[model samples]
Target: MICGVKQPILLVLVHSAPENFEKRKAIRETWGQDQEGVKLLFMLGIANESEVEKTLEEENVQYKDFVQGNFIDTYHNLTYKHVMVLKYAVYHCPEAKFLLKVDDDVFVNMPNLKIFMKLFMAQNSERKKILCSRMCGNPVLREGRWGVEISEYPESMYPNHCSGFAILYPHDTIFALYSEAQKTKYFWIDDVHVSGTLAKKLCVTHIGLEELILSDDEVVEIVDSSFINNTKPFLFGRMNLDVHQIRILWDFVSKYTPKKVILDYLNY
Candidate 1:
């Protein structure tokens, strides 16, 4: 869509608060690339109206910001803001080739991401199909890190659902998912609601999970390396991790280079 590059620009939807504002900004600094065709948009949430102006100035956030509102006030903390996220991505940045909806705490590996873009382009070549990290079936968390028991999906399992932390959807897929959400009033779990249910309606399929693209372990290692050794990491999922845990992980991995560290991680 841009003037030169064939690959569509990647739209990154970010959610940030006063506390993690600097952290997210730092994450962007590590991955900032002013390529001709690609652009990253940060859809931040401002909780306080009075502090909005000050927050923008302090955080260096632009005017293209939205106040987050959801079904439940303070809903699931970050999870509850999913609908607002969908609205912003679909309605606002329609020109993007792919929409990368990520939490403020997560870090993206941009170079590897370009590899993924090439792979997807090779497969469909249409650049229109929806692709998610394929799940075997409906999986549910049971007393695990993200375990939750909801009556709507009481089976305690999900069928081939992508993790909420990182999901990639084609531009057109947004319309299908949003339309289904309007018609169906079901569970509030954002991953299940969009990647599972709405995705089903949109005819979205899960892409194979690869080590580079999405993984829980890599998340920990990156965050760990960042703090312990004063090294910035690639794609650290901050939301799922506790602040103290983040500090600890960064402490452990920061001493090594990302390539050596991640390669070592793969070797083990």
Candidate 2:
């Protein structure tokens, strides 16, 4: 489907599995809500199971927000899914000013994100760089599902890259990154491959928002505050929170932030 119909300011592409129907719903009802300038769409791969595909189609028919890929939906093909979404954004949503790639489990604080983007856009100097929690010299795993064999990646340390938990990309960077991704060999650890290796190859500058990425302590603050006194101070950093937590956070955050388009960042 065509994008920028509303002349979108931000386009959020969620990396979701086809079967995580509830998680997608939680996102839609919470921070992923589309508004005047912000658009949200889910990117997935084809589910091999007929039942799963049928359910996805039903969901798609109702929402009309999915942009799926040809690859089979599996953990090993994340790179394929990642690249596919970038390609979609570049060709389909070229008018979008920003691209946000966040996984389903992450909790995105839209109010704080709006404030950050408001500030971020003013500084043209930082506009081209990737804004996210930067990961530098992360060790490559050699065991389990996330394992990277020496044959696959000979390096002991991953290049300085943005963690896939959440990444906010300038529209232009998406184009540049997508171009490079096409030429690069596929790497299964999509986080490292896309934001780390491909990014390093292009020499992309990453604006570190380490402080904004919430830790367990910050997550606890939300529950401890009973979701009220403390406004969402962090962004895109909740640890694989449950559906209930997402709803609770949304319920309280909605109470504090206005439903109208955010013109003033500080007030929210």
Best by lDDT: 2
| lDDT of candidate 2 over 39-111, digit per residue (tens) | 8889999998999999999999999999988889898999998888788889888888788898998888887
How well does candidate 1 match the true structure in TM-score terms? 0.65
As a TM-score, model 2 comes out at: 0.90
Model 1 per-residue lDDT tens digits across residues 1-268: 4422455567666655645665555555554334544556554444445565466655554533334453323335454466666676667666676777776565555654555555555556444344544455656775665667665467755755666767777777776677677787666567777787777666676654334342465555545444333233233333455445444444443344444232222110
Per model, state how many residue pairs clash.
22, 0
Q: Lowest-scoring 10 consecutive residues by lDDT in candidate 1?
A: 259-268
Residue 87 error, candidate 2, Å: 0.8
Please list the residue runs of candidate 1 whose C-alpha ends up more than 4 Å from where it truly belongs after superposition. Answer: 1-8, 32-34, 44-80, 125-150, 214-268
lDDT of each: 0.55, 0.79
After aligning candidate 1 to the native by TM-score, how far in Å is the CA of 16 from where it should be? 3.1
Error of 1 at 47 (Å): 2.8
